[model samples]
Target: MSSLNIATRALTTNMAALQVIGHNIANVNTEGYSRQTVQLQNAGYQSTGGGYFGKGVEIATVDRAYNAHLTREARITASTAAGDAARLERLEQLEALFPMGDKGLGSALNDMLNAWADLSASPSNSTARSVVISRADAFAARLRDTAGQIDLLRNSTQQQVGEHVDAINRLATELAGVNRSIIETAGGSHVPNDLFDQRDKLLADLSQYAQISVVPGEGGSANVFLGGSQPLVLGTQTGKLAVQRDPLDTSRINVMFTQGALATPLDANTLGSGALAGTLRFLNDDLSAIQNQVGRIALATSSLINQQHQLGVDLAGNMGGNFFVPTGPAQGLPAPTNASAATAAATVSNPQALIASDYELRVEATGFSVRRLSDGTTTALATLPAEIDGLSFSIGAGPAAVGDSFRIRPYEGAARNLQVAIAAPSSLAVASPVLVTPGTGNSAGMSVESLYARAPSANLTDPVTLTFNADGTFSATGLGPGNPPPDNPGPPASYNYTPGQPLQFNGWSLTLRGTPTAGDSFAIGAAPSSAIAQNAGNANGMLALRSLATFEGTALSDGYVSLFSDVGSRVQNAQFSAAFSSNVATTAEQARANVAGVNLDEEAARLLQFQQAYQASAKFLQIAQSTFDSLLQTVGR
Candidate 1:
């Protein structure tokens, strides 16, 4: 090649290099901008007699400093970190509701128990009885308030899920547009570095909402997938995601893809990592479990208290009524598509045997089946009145169709409905129905350890007297006589008196302790009527409630403590997970930056190098022009 052509080629290549260096330096702080370098190559040589002549340098192409694997790793780690952080924030809020120490549900339960103990001491004191009722009301109020807060959290999470889904759809659509622009601008010859940067930024934003996988498509376009397989963007055509209400649970929100004719619900477990996944996790697992636990405590408390209260007689000489109104079961009937009119209802049979779970009752071809949602345990249903896990289910009217089903939430809203049933202090059951007393003129000392009326409705018009005989046998009078007492027969049957054994007769039991002389006698009689003032001081039944075993064999107070501890532990675990995830994301981001990030110092050095090369190329052009001028002068001479 000639000197002029060589100098021109050198000048052009140097100018392009300077422009690339300037671009890199200008975009040093731009987010998602990768550093770019100019490629140089030797121009074609000309054939000569001795050897091929050398040529000056020419510009080859401009390349971006990007690592696809590193970028993908950063995106994955960012998605995980975002999910963990979101979950941790919500769990922290939930944990704050159930504060430990004296201010929480544990203290409220203790206050209720203490009130009951004080009422047992002075059963006739109207103030003490009122305190008991007040404490119970406080306990129920606390439970209801806590449950309401949990529901609020769940609702907030559902709302956030919907918002995130909208954001994901928006970003996906914008990313597809960017992909189309990049393909058209680049035209397959060179990479559009700015457009590529814009695409990367959009992907990073989208990953925060949902896990995404990106693949290079034809003509500089990209195809993005959600949760690894679901297509979100395919070569300039985008798909949308939506949030919809769950059919079985109207309160629950389900994430779905609306790409096809029919929307398809996405499995929560299949969602790899994102804010949407975290929100669903809290709603379906953590919040649901907490609500069930609160409901379980409510059911156990009401059932046990009502049962014990019924076994005693109030100051009015009447059997104790229910202490609390039990919560009814929650039912979700089948969709209107089912032809059967058969409906199912569930009632609590044994509160102590109840589990914190929801049940699905399905009518199969052969029989009905009840499945526990928590553990997936399926039990076959028998006749109409079928019982399982303490719940008695009854089907109504006609035979159920094969596809007919019902969801039974035995304790879903129990806490919200828990309340004090009794309004009058005089109605508190704190006395035994039958009273036992020692007869006058008895020598040996014998005391009644316990006394209970076996049949509250049985008429006990006359008192029954037990006289100890010389042969250690006891004879009863006032009750009907004979081994099997006949109607209206006088006197009672005789029997051996065993120390510390309960003597049962005439629908009543009297437990006596200590040895008695032959002349010692005990009398058992009915409690006085409501008009009698002495009945107010009796607290035998109230004292017995102090050691009552309720709430799955544990004290009610202990159950609340366990629930508080569980919430605290979950919060701690969530905090740790969030921190660990953040660290992983930071490391992955640093690695990606090492390959694609622009360093101002490196760009500055390249800028100086390119400037000197441009100056040298200009000098070469000047020397070639001067030589040509001198050669022209000589030719003129």
Candidate 2:
């Protein structure tokens, strides 16, 4: 009876080992399935008077071949790779928008400047004037088109963020349900290895969306966290991730993690690493920064050109108006969470001083603090209407709370609505309004040098005459309405004369060289239709803009190149990071697979070994049975 019992136990244990080997072979290709091994040990020993007799083998417990460290490393590296790849995808698109050669914003601007150069050569050519106007229109169209395409890209990116958030929420809920199932099925002595595999697999999938932390909980349940200590899954419950728009700037959105009634918004740079984190980072940082750069160019182009255009006279001999309409500063808006009625207003005070960045204006105990979002730098302001980066901020209305905040975007949408306000070729300001004429009857060989207007005033165009007296002195007539108002509203009593000297009058400058006759007289005044046909002074100003270090200490063309290179560099860096992280992730995953991944050949070898054991146990059982039968027959005999 004892021999039979031992054979029976041996046969059952070997058979169980064979079954485990077969199960491993069946799921050889299953993802996240850890290879299982059968555990076996001696059933027991029965002690008698003579000695102890060893019993057959018995199954102990099925164990999984898994290493937690390798698995965790794999997930971490995968999350990093996902984030870099996603950011690189968006940056490549941005790079294409700001091109290097032809079809670029810089190219359009160059062509426009060339048009002005042509007008300078032929100031009275109607066709040349029309070409300048046409080039202006074309440049404006390109600006608007580029801005529109960027807007579309931004919209697409924002939509993807929403989709990623939805996917994360769904994954969280599914994982929570799986956790509940784990709790229910884990209450037995025999562990549910399959359920453990499922839980691990779900966790790996969830890690693709956001960086997370997994903690072992009771009865095989896991508590998952995200956004640093914010629980996404607490045992059997799930939290939600959502997108919320900035009340100050609706164009921007924020991501939040909500559990029960508690919710918190994530900082732009603190999401760790994942596909969702990458998408949000790109949407909030990359998109806004590049758009601000493009808008900065647009604002500078309009502001500089229009200012010069207003100082000149058009083909019709009328003072030139704005050639391109100025764009927005996108006034600051108080945050919705603020508890104050105080408001802040912003304006583009000096376009040349502007940089492409968003700012945060927070009311402080002392006064206020302006934070530059680009580099996380803050500037304190103890007064209102202060200028920073070309944006002037002033208080408007009542004040209350010290912690009130407002967002100020000086160049967000400035490029979107840029347009050429000049509709006719005749509106091109190629002529300087002020003109200086040398004395026709001079005998001292006096010659006029360059003459141009420096500014404008109510009486800037008023006519003035200078008469060289016999005492080597000059008297000015009809000069009261211009520069240096005449004493008693009449011409200056007298003025000393010097050869090769510049005379400033009536918002204009006149330079003369060579000796002047005592009776010599010169006339200077606003250009009439007669002078407008031959004047190309203001066109020269436009040509000078090509070499002006007006855009952040670089020429307008060089500035665009700088921006393009900056974006390209970002894309290149992201590509390198993505590839490196992906390689690391692959290494980690392989390391994990070496331990827990099912191997068909290994399983086959174990299957054969277990098969032989089972056969041996069966033969032993057969021998035991035969002996028993033979003993019974002998007793009967």
List model 2 lDDT by residue over 73-125, tens digit each. 98888888888888889888888888766788888888887898778879889
The top-ranked prediction according to lDDT is 2
Residue 556, candidate 2: how far off, in angstroms?
A: 1.5
In order, the Cα lDDT scores of the candidates are 0.78, 0.81
Error of 1 at 306 (Å): 2.6
Query: Model 2: runs farther than 4 Å from truth?
Result: 48-50, 185-187, 338-342, 363-369, 397-403, 436-525, 631-637
Lowest lDDT 10-mer window, candidate 1?
481-490
After superposition, which runs of candidate 1 have C-alpha atoms over 4 Å from their true positions? 1-8, 47-51, 185-187, 335-337, 434-526, 530-553, 630-637
RMSD of 2: 5.6
lDDT of 1 by residue, 1-637 (tens): 2888888888888889888888888888888888889988889898889899878788788989899889999988999999888888889899888876777887887787677666555667889888988988998899889888888888888888889988998988899999889878765667788788889989998888778888888666788988558888998888888888877666567888878676878988778788888878877878887788888888877776676677667767777888887666555566556678888878878766777887888887778898898889999865657888777888887888887888777777888788889899888876766777787878756777766543333544358888886666677777743323332222334576677776767656577888778878888776666523344223443343334454556655577876777788888898998899999999999999999988888888888898898888889889999999999999999
Of the candidates shown, which would achieve the greatest TM-score relative to the real structure?
Answer: 2
Clashing pairs in 1: none
- Each prediction's TM-score versus the true structure: 0.84, 0.85
